[model samples]
Target: MKPKQTLSWKPFVLSAAVLLILFPFVYLVLLSLASEWRFPDLLPSYFGLRNWATILGSEAGLLESFVSSLLISLSVAMVSTTSGFLISRAVFYHPKKNTLTLLAYFPYILAPVVFAACLSFFFLKMGLFGNITGVIVAQFIIAFPYALLFFSSFWNKKVKSYEDLVATLGGNRWQTYIKVLFPLAKGLLLICFFQTFLISWFEYGLTSIIGIGKVQTLTIKVFLFIKEANYYYGALSCCLLIFPPIVLLYFNKRYVFKKLV
Candidate 1:
């Protein structure tokens, strides 16, 4: 018998893909750490943590922006996940499941900017515009569709069967949720949390429109830095922006591999 040949293309393709994704970020980190990276320079003239220091110190409101971003993102994650989980459950069992499912995709499909535009008038009317709480509400509204779709996918035949088994075992709704559903869907819930948090974190269009520029999250800060020709600060903010998601992705990947093992 002839020995089997290995696929030589796979590794090359995968490595290229990884580089494509990571190279920009590597450059961003380099730029962020650089004090001066002028034209024609392959590397920075001065390397220091000045940008980081400036952002972290009271010199800029970045620390305050970071806190605000954290509060908003965390709150959006909690609200979107919890509310979406509950809403998905109802929609899954609803008599008008088809209509509701179709409706659930609307917000997600709409261009976030256009959606924000259409809602801006209503936000004004409801006194949500320019308020941090209002921006949170807008993010939740925008993120709900994604959460709904995600959790809706969780309630498949197998999940339903397990749920029925719990019911047959005399587990009440709360008991079933706490014991069965919670453990079963824990990873998915975490994914949803991260996704929704990320959605809220990187949101510029919706926050800008809804907050009326009053609430400046990290995304806003990055844009502000760029608009003001502060490229070093912009790069620093970019690094900060990508840091959490990358960390979460790494941990999630590790957890998945551990589970598989």
Candidate 2:
């Protein structure tokens, strides 16, 4: 019965961890909908949809920023993941792998703020400062490390023998990747896409510094609202900003959780 007892503990621990992670998000939702949130109070005295309504109706640039954020995130995710996948594949095929492997993960070792600062100077020199393209480039750099790490694991484990098998069947390299390797790596690719998306969406320092007044994103707007003491509006805007990733997470939970387990 030791195995049975150990299994029982697993559910209990997992439930506790889930609740711990979700509690702040639940509170954030409550605060977003609340008419007023006072610190001394355990909970809001009144809750209404007024906050959501006001932001959605009155805010002019919020939707634009939301779209910009979505576009930037999607673009960064696609470019970084694709580049990382290709690089990882090349590394996998390389006769000497260590140097390429090190290069792939090098960006991740740098602090994000430091990297952003370096990029800011480069952008200024290139006259790309305060531009959407500049922000996208920075995000691509940030997201590539995560994509490389994730795809490398999938490629090594699932596709190590793929080339040999494809050669035996008289298939070329491209055909092998397209038919055998890619299908097996789909789950990891999805995971990388969403991971990179989140990183780009929530990125504040880089976006603010690089984009300046030109390319506004949801995170920048949220920070600006807070600085202006528009807590309600900020909270409401945040709720809208949070919805996309939450929906993605919900839809991908089965696959993501299975991998976690």
Candidate 3:
């Protein structure tokens, strides 16, 4: 009876927690859609799809920014994830990998804006300033550290055990990777790729600094709208910024449930 009671409460508590966490996003959607949501009111005075419709249409260069954001994020994800996976493999197999892993943590600890400032001079020298290619490269700086960290977790004894099993079955390193490692880590790899994409997608400081305002990502667009006191469009852009993360959350939840099942 006691165990059953505890189990029953768990679902209720988790559901409440999930809703509590998601309420802000719900509010943001309402706020974006609310044409005149004045203060001291629990609900909006008026509600319409005008914001979404406008943002999706030819208003404020949003369509262009949306496409640019997509392209940059996808490109950053693939490049960063692939390179991180390759480099992490080498580092993980190295005898001094512990030291290397410790070093990798250093770069991510700095605030991105500050890091961007530090790299600005070098970017100028390399003629990467104001370049979309440079923006990708700058964003990679943030994504790569996270990528290395993520891939590191996938390289423990459990993975090593499989490697050993493959070796025993007469497989070399490449065969082991193609047959065992890649297959086993495919789900994790996909997650890592998307995580990198999210990082690049939301990045503002690095892109602004490196691209020198030439590259206008959705994040930049959001800030620009906010700077102009256009909260409606800002909220609209905010929706675009957050939508992918929600999709990502759904993917992670589904993946976890599948693993559990």
Instruction: Give the top-scoring candidate (lDDT).
Output: 1
TM-score of each: 0.86, 0.81, 0.82
What tens digits encode model 2's per-residue C-alpha lDDT throughout 151-216? 655656436677788899899988987998778778877887888888899888878888986898
Candidate 2, pairs of clashing residues: none
RMSD of each: 3.9, 4.5, 4.5
Local accuracy of candidate 1 as per-residue lDDT tens digits, 1-261: 999998799899999999999999999998899977888998889898888888757776888888899999999999999889878988987788889999888889988878988999999999989989989999999898988888876777898898899899988999888998889889888888888888999899989889887998989988898898888888888888889888888877644333222
Q: In candidate 3, what are the lDDT values of residues 98-182, reduced to their tens digit? A: 9998889988788888899899999899988997888888888888988887888678789889999989999998999899888
Best-performing candidate as measured by TM-score: 1
Ranking by TM-score: 1, 3, 2
Judged by lDDT against the true structure, how good is candidate 1? 0.86
lDDT assessment of candidate 3: 0.84
Estimate the TM-score for candidate 2.
0.81
Kindly give the stretch of ten consecutive residues in candidate 3 with the minimal lDDT sum. Answer: 252-261
Which of candidates 1 and 2 is the stronger one according to lDDT? 1
Q: What is the Cα-based lDDT of residue 145 in candidate 2? A: 79
